[model samples]
Target: MRNTSDISISVVVSCTAQTAALLPWTLKAVMAQTSPSHDIIVVENSAVPELPSMPAREARRLRLLHLPGAARPALRNAGLAAAQGVLVAFCDSGDLWKPSYLAIMREMWRVEPRLLLAYGDAVPLQGDTWGTERGFANAPTGFWDGQRSLGPLLSVFDQPPMPRLLEFQPFLPSGLVAQRGFLERVGGWDTACTLLPGHDFATALRLARHALFGIMQRAMVGVRPEADGPAHAQAVNMGEARILERALARDETLWSQAQVIRAAIVRRRQAALAIAFARGDLAAVQEIAALLPQQERSSPTLLKLGLAALPAPLRRAGSAALFGLGASRTSLRWPGN
Candidate 1:
């Protein structure tokens, strides 16, 4: 293997006002890496560009790019443009990296010079507590089983099927590291996809088309939980549907599975509609319902439509009683509902 010292890495962190408080912990993790990065860039996208103070020694290699009020994709793109390393890694404001994270990634790149994109598993952090499940556990069954092992801890997806990626996206930006040249070749982040929940997933889909992808089986990153609520769920569903639509439009390979993709899109919209209905957002409910296929005469579709037609107050009450206005409001119970 090539010398690890020869590999240069830049870490890009995306932050907003809401997540700025956790930035110190994130910076601490980055600074503590066994294989230190060439530089650390934090892109602050908020109304006011501000960051917590750091010691002179720690701040020397750290730079702040203040893109006030910019969207996530734009923030990341800005960081990518300013990065001056051979490999670029991304982290969210509240996420963390284990001390060995960069060392492991550098070793993997040294061993496999063809790797364009690689990601590892991240353990979810809820407040100060860590979750037992790693991020890869969320991947669909048998998804990783087909990968060819580069080593005991490394697996490469040799020409992964596009359908599988579309079906269940398992990539997270926080866990990803990519070659700077390959990232630029793929056009970096899609600035057009601003404010979308799964823009990173969408970008990964684009990269997966031609890049050599790899997975580190070990969990080397920590992911903090995002806001939880029905509105958040609704936005996620809508964003996912949009991503599927864009993929179907551009990729002819997915044309064969148009029906499957369409069905998936409808399922997402239906979930969004359900959330809208539960939250008493009648306008959103009707708007989302209109996008669903007219041929969907399923009982759930009929029931949702019928409920949507009733008086606003009655509809809200009925939705709460049926779906239980708690955690279940995020998704419908019945399949295809």
Candidate 2:
């Protein structure tokens, strides 16, 4: 394994047909990294024939992999295999990284050479909605404990973290940096987790089970909300649920911790359904609602369903009222209704 002195980072920016427009910005951020020696691999998982040309510096550092119709997780796995750097980092198209992101994470790895992963908070570029990155910043730290650092607010979750310590996913792929060797040892991203809802979280959780990790409280990355952010939320909701269910099944001891997370996911779904109903998007409401298991539906979901059944005009007005008046009183749900 290479030492931090010989630090060379391989940043994997995964792009898709829908995310093509954001690729330039993502690559630009990579060019601005404070670290001196690093390369980038863009795994384009789309049927698009060609990618936009990159700037000279980024072009020099980049190796384009055209998978032409590949799953997200598979794209990541491909990037993982192709990466040659001692340390590896990942971010999606459209997300912007702070200039110091790589520098700080590298410092953390320098401090603890055995670290399997280092991740931090991200600021939401879109509107601050329920369960958004902005909200996560305000939420209390349950699994991760904060630490003081010269650059950012840092935290360290010891290797083999306390059971269920990863119940709440506090990080994203954009915010994480990991050692290549450690990742290889644990096996790369689960290709089966073709859906993200929790692929990033599940991978991190599984790594946390065996390796040391770090976290930064301050936002190190700025994640842009998708064009159809609400629609993406539904996918994420399903993704998280599936990941948790599989995890729980594998280790029943995590049931207590998993239950808290399970309830949270359910509530998020209910909140999303409410938002959809309020926005007068009956179709979206129905679609999101159908995704939830019948047994998991809660009172809030029932209320949202009733609200959605109202006339479109009334539903829109009620949604605005619920979101506006209930801002402080009601627990705001996920983004985009």
Tens digits of lDDT, candidate 1, 1-337: 6788998999999987777889989899999998999999999876336557878887888888988788767888889989999999999888888899999999888888788889888777877676667767677677677777778789787774455665566667788899999899889987766667656667766777764688898988888756556677687778878988988898798788899888878877877887876676767877887888888645665676777788878987766666554236464320011
Lowest lDDT 10-residue stretch of candidate 2: 328-337
Of the candidates shown, which would achieve the greatest lDDT relative to the real structure? 1
**Deviation of model 1 at 82, angstroms:** 1.8
Alpha-carbon lDDT, every model: 0.78, 0.66
RMSD of 2: 5.3
TM-score of candidate 1 versus the correct structure, residues matched by position? 0.85
Q: For each candidate, what TM-score against the reference?
A: 0.85, 0.73
Clashing pairs in 2: none
Kindly report which residue stretches of model 2 are placed more than 4 angstroms away from their true locations once superposed: 1-4, 47-60, 126-136, 141-143, 146-152, 159-167, 195-199, 227-235, 250-337
